[model samples]
Target: MLQPVPFPIRKECPPGACICERERLLDDPQGDTRILRLTSEEEKRLVARIDSISTYADLQHIEERMREQLGIDLRISPGMHEVRTVRGFNIQIVERPGLCRKTRQSIPAAIRRCLDKNPDIAYAILNAHDLLRDD
Candidate 1:
């Protein structure tokens, strides 16, 4: 049986960037090298792929579910959180989503309010992508 030989391919890069092609010698275990920049959607797809519980084909399924339920994405760190001291005597309210001077409002306040109200919330993040799709 005969097999056809493969050929090499070339690509161009944008200005101010260098794209070098390197080929390692035989016996070297190192594989090919490459750099890739993934978009947020790409990251979500990867996450969904890695998720064992969700048999989702893409991030959209999980994202839509999360956004519909949480009104935020998995990356959305709440504006605030409440913690009870180990002694169980003191309850602390922490607001780190500092104030937005532009609107003279604090992001933490909104986050905190949401967290304080939802005691059963296991995880709350702003799923903006999924929320937007709903509209």
Candidate 2:
């Protein structure tokens, strides 16, 4: 089932300054990029929610909500995930794609850099692609 995640209210910013996009070589291990400017709380909540997903298909629903509510510009790659059982316990493990942000050096850096710089502007980049689909 696809649940709707609320989109955080964004403060007004200059036109075309809300988000940024960058492209890397197709052969590069990392995929394309999308930088989203969010608040500290919003970033944490979003990441936590995504991390909580137990299935790739569920992540796809979140991605769809992001595009619908947030904007079509943002990209979300759910990638691959699996659920396993052990000792009557079920665990879901997912391989998250690379997420990063811009650095003072103008090079792409880890997402932590953005979180460290300004929690208010939770700038994050998400590698948007998928390896599976829902049946």
Candidate 3:
């Protein structure tokens, strides 16, 4: 008899929009994608970095560093939000269900380690939303 593989329990979120466990919509043969939510301090730092971008070169530098270090794709586009003029964006660190539960759970810690080692990647994610807003 073959033993059944155990899967990680999906985190439950309350009704309404919650960033705690956002699901990524894409072609994932593996399964649903999990997003890495930032902590309050991290969010503050990211907002500050986003506010500091004064030139296209600065944004480009952040993007390059993130790709090189985190191996994650950055995407920015015009989107509708609560405010008519505001744009929505997403910087996703995807972990598929096919991956070992341990590996999947370690994603956040791994990202934090990378951020601590080189913070520019976090800046890239924060600044991504600003790209469409500035234009």
Of the candidates shown, which would achieve the greatest lDDT relative to the real structure?
A: 3
lDDT of 3 by residue, 70-120 (tens): 333444333344322222322234443222333333333344444444445
Question: Which window of ten consecutive residues has the lowest lDDT sum in model 1?
Answer: 95-104
| Candidate 1 C-alpha error for residue 88, in Å | 13
Global Cα lDDT for candidate 2? 0.33
For model 1 the local lDDT of residue 57 reads: 30
Give the higher-lDDT candidate: 1 or 2: 2
| Candidate lDDT values, in order | 0.28, 0.33, 0.40
| Comparing 1 and 3 on lDDT, the stronger one | 3
Question: 4-25, model 2: which lDDT tens digit per residue?
Answer: 2244322333455422222221
Could you give candidate 1's per-residue lDDT for residues 1-135 as a string of tens digits? 212213322222334343222122111334221111222344344334433232213334544553453222333332343334112112122211111121112222333343344433212122332321334
Clash totals in order? 7, 0, 0
